[model samples]
Target chain A: MNNQKIAVIDHKCANLHSVIKALEIFKIDVKICTSKTELKDIDGIILPGVGSFDPAMKNLIKQDLVDSIKNLTFSGTPLLGICLGMQLLMENSEEGSLNGIGLINGTAKMIESNEEDIKIPHMGWNNIEINDNNNSRILNGIKNNDYFYFVHSYKCIPTNNSEVAAFTKYGQKICAVIEKNNVFATQFHPEKSGIVGLKIYQNFLSFIEIGK
Target chain B: MIINKGNILLTKRIIPCLDIDKGRVVKGTSFLSLKDAGDPRELSNFYNNQGADELVFLDITASSEHRNIILDVVEKVSSEVFIPLTVGGGIRNLDDIRNLLNSGADKVSINTSAIENPDIIRKSSEEFGSQCIVVAIDAKRNNNSWSVFTHGGRVLTELDAIEWAEKVNSLGAGELLITSMDEDGQQKGYDIDLLKSIQKKVNIPIIASGGAGNLKHMLEALTIGKSDAVLAASIFHYGKYSIKEVKDYLNSENVPIRLI
Candidate 1:
């Protein structure tokens, strides 16, 4: 596990420092990758992002990393997306005009609530209910209805419900975690979610270990 | 388990604020008369361990010479603490926001700069996501209404508190950290009227700060005040209450608190 290298895609969004710091606690080698060459022979890939959809996609396109990510995932490299990174896995998003990475069958839509109490950004700690039948590896030790920190305005809606590993209720059933083949994504920042969130990274590392 | 009748519960946050002076954490009464608290990294780690939803570090150093001191503190603290960290005080432009974010701060709060150049809010939010840009408004009640203050509440601006909140919301700020000057350090309670007025004007989450002396005050700010989060300093800094104790109190009150 110490020798296994994990590449964190830096799309010039907000700081990728926390994500890297979180992974480092597991004693695995982590590298910040901006171009295709940096993705070579990596054991795992982490797509962490913050900010708008169009500019993030544009940053990936400018670095010519769109196809590299798709091809890597096509070959079954475990890829995990966080927040906007999760939204980018969908075909498109209503927040912007650009197309997504198209790794999953879904779209990112704005979370609207008629109830005055429910906020738009959903910025706080919220509990999640794991999909009983999905048997997601990332949520292996995570219990049902455990709280995790979240900060976002948009929610990911997967076309296939089976792909959703977990869901959290805000105003409606919002997709909190998705697992499809080699790709896994979460709508919350695990790095900032404290201990339970660290357990998630631990599970992801175990998944990578099994793959090896 | 505040609303456990088959309803989704997004718990309200309880943030511990540390006002940094020089390098150590400090607390002041209504933004004056500073007193030393503890080390930033140690206190931050303690709060994170005690189940603080988030932490805010306000650099209260008066001189420009010690401005870089907070950045070093942020860098050291962010490496150890995993929860979301927000740093405010002396942020001037996008570069300052970028510098703090790069130094591992999850959010950067701008007060005086946002007033000096309102466009800074829009530009910084556009450059970085609105989620990472927090606009801190220090407001003081003036007779029938409230006015926004800047420079650690030492300078007054003609901007109406509610109007400024609406403007910042439109300008793309993700959250507003409103500190009440009148109730600050008084330990009576938060400015409930001030929070309610701003909450009505903007859809963004508001963090109520100042005048947190007891548990009921914190509950009142979250319930009657309608704030998404409550930021307190002296109570926690002086060891009057623990974050767990406050959360337990709120949880017992059915406030949907996150209990670790």
Candidate 2:
């Protein structure tokens, strides 16, 4: 069926350069899917995004692809959601009145600062502290304090603590990477993160080499 | 002459403007042509290593009424490269400015607030020092003079671009990133006349942007416009040229730059 190994859910968000470029670096082939009609034969998936929850989820609904995502996770495909994509992994979001894919039981909340109120849509690069026991092959060659790019004000606070794989602080310990069994997601853009980020794509490539 | 590969600070930086929307690198082709480009961390790192000199990630989109993509873009890039990073958009008071600086950015650029509240220039300079705070002015030529545009070039403010440049200089802005909105993404060439006007107005290092099409465009921005630096987008993002090649041309022509 000419099934590509990776599928990047387009969903009308910009910045696929990071994901596409990273996958290219690792020699991993990726197929873009802004709709459900295109994701059927993909071996593994990467939901890369940047934008609001409501509109993004709306796009997903518009394409009627939410169920397909849920079904794919159950079928044991490795799925990784980046940044806003990570927020979409949750059940609901406060940013724009919308419900996420509900892959993980959590609510996306704003990071509160003790200072004279921190400017959000928290901009700039910071450190990520990995904190999970997930043995998923996606993180096989990963390390701690490996910096990844971030650009969001809201984060997914997993209702199920076991869902979190990593986190970074912006006046709060927000969820960074969430892995629930075969479905995994990261709030950071590994594509834009240089070397360490390259390793992530490499690992993902090896994890979902399209066998299952 | 395109020698240094990823020396973003050197090659007349061809920064791809990332207007972060909902935590993604929203590609606004004509300034509002919003399209998702994947993740910021991956894109910024790729651009940095791929030969983009510094990156400007604007958070507020000209108004504070929407979402911010600062922490997300920052946390991703700094971990990826050792390149210089400048963040702007929706920066209001001094606190917002300082927070960005402390977050691993080499500099912070301010626009709307600088015009709305002139005090911001002085206060940010006093605390973070002039070099850390970059005053970003987005302008469009109006009638006989150059007029400043605020909020992503959506509003035409009463401030004159050159006059604001001079005042921004006096307020201790370490550098000035002046974007010519009328010429942005046109890829014809730089706004030499406008840059020349500002060059005569302010002494701070200027990053001339808008209409950088080819090597000659960058050369014109530096030699004719007398701008200290040049910035562009399409040429780099589309792989038309490399930063190393641009800097090589500049250095070959005796234009001093940070060669790595």
- Model 2 chain B scores worst on lDDT over the 10 consecutive residues at B2-11
True contacts kept of 1: 0.80
Clashing pairs in model 1, backbone N/Cα/C closer than 3 A: none
Task: State the lDDT at B203 in candidate 1.
Answer: 85
Compose the digit string of candidate 1's lDDT tens values, residues A34-122: 99888898988999988888899999998899999999999989999999999999999999999999999989999987888777778
Per-residue lDDT of B175-218 in model 2, one digit per residue for the tens? 78889898887888888898889888775668888888899889
Interface RMSD of each: 1.2, 13.0
Task: List ranges where model 1 is wrong by over 4 Å.
Answer: B1-9
Q: Least accurate stretch of 10 residues (summed lDDT) in model 1 chain B?
A: B1-10
Which stretches in model 2 have alpha-carbon errors above 4 Å? A1-4, B1-53, B56-135, B138-260
What's the CA error at residue B216 for candidate 1, in Å?
A: 0.4
Q: Find the candidate with the highest lDDT and give its number.
A: 1
